[model samples]
Target: MAKKLELGDPAPQFDLREDGGGTLSLASFAGKKLVLYFYPKDDTSGCTMEAIDFNRLLPQFTRAKTAIVGVSPDSCASHEKFKAKHELGLTLLSDETKKMLEAYGVWIEKSMYGRKYMGVERSTFLIGPDGRIARAWRKVKVPGHAEEALAAAKSL
Candidate 1:
């Protein structure tokens, strides 16, 4: 596993297929802060709630000059359905190969019910306009996460 990224580290760059079409890249977010969140799957309870929370607070994030993008191993088609079902406003990117996930150090070994497996650890990164990580939250709790992220973005 790659070392966990720390504050001030350059955020990993990514170019991925986004839901509803088109590509999203780290360069596209230049001159603006980014909230890059990783979730294990689409449409799962925690993932859905996290997306909803980010969607709900999207306007605030926009006002803060921050853009939010959610990443998951789900396909672009799956992302589309999930976004539509939840009426999500933020971008959802597919990382089917998990390259970006590994680059960001969020794809990790996880244990549930005494069983170990590889999965995306629910994580969030705040990347400043200068492209350095401002903050990171690993093993994120869904509730109130968006708000906390927004607060950090606003401080940037």
Candidate 2:
């Protein structure tokens, strides 16, 4: 069962393969604010826009002392291709096993045109330096979402 996350709850831990042949873990981001965004797939319209938006604002996010990391079920190779194709300047993590996806509760059943299937729900979590969730957004709409997240991160 997926738990409904609340503010101040400890962010779910994860250690996953990154696009650049390195491992990134929740513990690795200790004491740093993290903007962790999860999307359904790579190379999709909405997902691409979201990734670009986040990437474009990399400098601002960096200035705020916050790191942004994107996560999806796509393999490390796929993530690398997506990054190269889009010229995205953000770290992308692969969760091929869906362990991190399940822990974050973004992997869920969805109905589309009367068909039900399991997939990622497009979510974002703002993890505080203390390792607790400061904010959580589920079923995210892409437009202006990255800017909103940046604002929140700046305030923290």
Candidate 3:
């Protein structure tokens, strides 16, 4: 496993396909703060709630000059369906290759019902305009995560 990233560390670079057919690069957010969240799957309960929460705070994040993007191993098509079904207002990135997940250190072994397997841990990273991570949340809980991230971004 890659070392866990800490605050002030340079955010890992990525170029991935976004939902609804478009590309997004980490460099593209160069002059803007970002709320980069990693979720396990599209259309799942927790993931859906998390996306909705972020969408609900979209205007606040915009006023704070922060862009929100959710990443998952699902394909762009899956993301599109999820976004449409949920009316999500933020961007969603497809990381089928799982390279970005590993680079961010969110892909790891997990257990449920006493069975262990590899999966993406729910995580969120607040990246500053200068590309360094301002804050990171591992094993994130969905309820107020979006608001928490926004608070950190606003402080940055």
Please, what is the TM-score per model? 0.98, 0.98, 0.98
What RMSD does each model have against the real structure?
0.7, 0.6, 0.7
Name the candidate, 2 or 3, with the larger lDDT value.
2
Best by TM-score: 2
lDDT of 2 by residue, 52-143 (tens): 99999999999999999999999999999999999998999999999899998899999999999989999999999999999999989999
- Residue-level lDDT of model 3, residues 87-154, one tens digit each, is 88789999999999999999999999999998999999999989999899999999988889988988
Indicate the worst ten consecutive residues by lDDT in candidate 1.
81-90
Candidate closest to the true structure, highest lDDT: 2
The global C-alpha lDDT for each of the candidates, from Candidate 1 onward, is 0.94, 0.95, 0.94
lDDT of the structure predicted as candidate 1: 0.94
What is the RMSD of candidate 3? Answer: 0.7
Q: Tell me which of candidates 1 and 2 scores higher on lDDT.
A: 2
Which 10 successive residues of model 2 have the least lDDT summed?
1-10
